[model samples]
Target: MERIYLDNNATTIVDPVVKEAMDPFYCQMYGNPNSLHSFGTEVHPYMKIALDRLYSGINARDEDDILITSCATESNNTVIKGIYYSLIRTGRKSQVITTQVEHPCVANSCRFLESLGTDVVYLPVNEDGIVTPEILREYINPDKTALVSIMWANNETGLIFPIKELCKVTHENGALFHTDAVQAIGKIPVNVQETGVDFLSFSGHKFHARKGVGGLYVRKGTDLPTFMHGGEQMASRRAGTIDVPGFIGMGLAMELAVRNLEYEATEVRRLRDKLEDAILSLKDVLVVGRREIRTPNTILASIRGVEGEALIWDLNRSGVAASTGSACASESLESNPTFVAMCISDELAHTGIRLSLSRFTTEEEIDRSILVIRQSIERLRNISSR
Candidate 1:
């Protein structure tokens, strides 16, 4: 049986071109970027080139605005805690605002900050899993707000948030804005300059680059405290010896993504809509946030009376790979908080399954996946009824 992987939101397979771009850095150019030796000097220019590519990929104003990190988790932690700590010293703003549907990293970071006696507000989303600018204005106050961290696109429901407008609101209140764009970076156009976000976090593996590498876009002049403490790497913003091969792969991946973004958006959206239509044709099934503005490659559907884990297992046996929710929170038995925040019933939330596509996802895979999902949901429903 052929395997159909539809878990792009969890992670993506590394592109062969990106792998090839990383080959030289692994063995031939194995020199510490901070070293002064000629071998190291040769490696430095490649890092510069990678930074330049990333800058172009996001339309960043300057290369220095980007800080290389291990993953979006670290970046999220840095932004939330960094801003909180910086402001705590000056006794200025003490409130941090974020949506209820944030990823585990950002959500937990806020929880942790709250434990430290900081005011953290988790704004609720609408039934469509969105936080409108009007709702944001209610919580934002220039006198006491420090940071507003929201995600650009949700990983589970694929709902796209109004980051550009939200950032403007944040700035008007004299607060910095951060967006976890891990799922949105390659799937949508992300121009940092246009958005005016003070900080943005994105991971490599989400965009066909190698895992264990990601970036934090810190707007120039943002007073963000450093997260890591070691050698003066990442212009003293982040510390540690950089992963040369990973950065090279990420740069190549970003370059490829920017070049193929239009094609990717069209193709993935077509396949996703096809899958959604087929799944919705089945009885007693509902697509989460279907009418909302979402990413091009995600479909979160709920099949009544069927458990998501059971459906996923059945699909896996049939050579179809999918997910229940965010990969980071999959280990937990609890239902997806995003659905709960939307006030979806427990039965529907428990049955939610997410299928996220990629540029490499083929139409045939989507067709097969739809068939497999229909069969799995039917079989599971039959079993539950019995």
Candidate 2:
């Protein structure tokens, strides 16, 4: 049986070009960038090229601090906890704001802060699965709220938030803004200067770069306390030797993603719509958000009377890779959190499944997968009915 991959949102296969670019660093120029010896110094030029790619990919300025970290989880922890240590712990502020639909790292970090007496407000999303500026204003305590962390694109639903407008609101309220751009970076154009976000977190694996490498963008002169200790690496904002090979590949991947963003918006989106149309044509199935509001390559659909896990298993057996939701919590046996946040019906919430595509997802794969998906769903629905 031929296999088709439709789980790019959970993680993407590394691009072969990126792999080829990273291969030489392992044995050829294997050296710590911090070392002054020839081996280490030999990699500096390549490192500079990688850094330049990263900065240009996101439109970050020269003065901004792009600290390389282990993953988006670490980058997120650094931002949330850094704010606590920098402002909240200092007694200058006591509250933070985030949406109820944030990724686990951001959501759990806020919960941790709340345990320490910090007032954390989780703003609710509307039925459209979005936190409107009006809702933000209703809950924003301007005098006390120090930071507002929102994701640029939701991991489960792939809904794109109005980061530029939200950042403006947060700034007007005198609070710093942060966005988890893990899902948005490669699929959409991200300009930190235009959005005016104080901090942004991104992961490599989401965009065809190898896993275990990510970065945090800190605007110039932002006072974020160090999240790690014991080393002066990453300008002392983060400690530990960098993953040179991972970063190199990630930098190239980012550049490629940005360069081919138009293709993603066009071809990838067309295939996504074709897949969604097939799913929606079935009885009692609906997509989470309108296509206009979501990233180009994602589809979150709910099939009534069918269990999400059962559908996923059925699809897997048919040689199609799909997801019930975020891979971070895939094994938890829980309902779709995005549906829950959108106030979807309990019966339908448990039936949600996500199918995400990537630049490499070809038309032929989508065509073949559509037939398999339809067969899987029909079979599952029949069994559930019986």
Evaluated with TM-score, which candidate comes out highest? 2
* Residue-level lDDT tens digits of model 2 in 226-319: 9899688887879999899999999999999999899989989999999899888888888889899999999988888777878888889889
Return the lDDT, model 1, position 336: 70
| Regions of candidate 2 where Cα sits further than 4 Å from its true position | 326-332
Per-prediction TM-score to the true structure, in the order listed: 0.96, 0.97
Per-candidate local distance difference test? 0.88, 0.90
**Top candidate when judged by lDDT against the true structure:** 2
* Stretches of model 1 off by over 4 angstroms after superposition: 326-331
Model 1 accuracy (lDDT, Cα) = 0.88
- Model 1, residue 131: what's the lDDT? 91
For every candidate, C-alpha RMSD to the true structure in Å: 1.8, 1.7
Error at 34, model 2, angstroms: 0.7
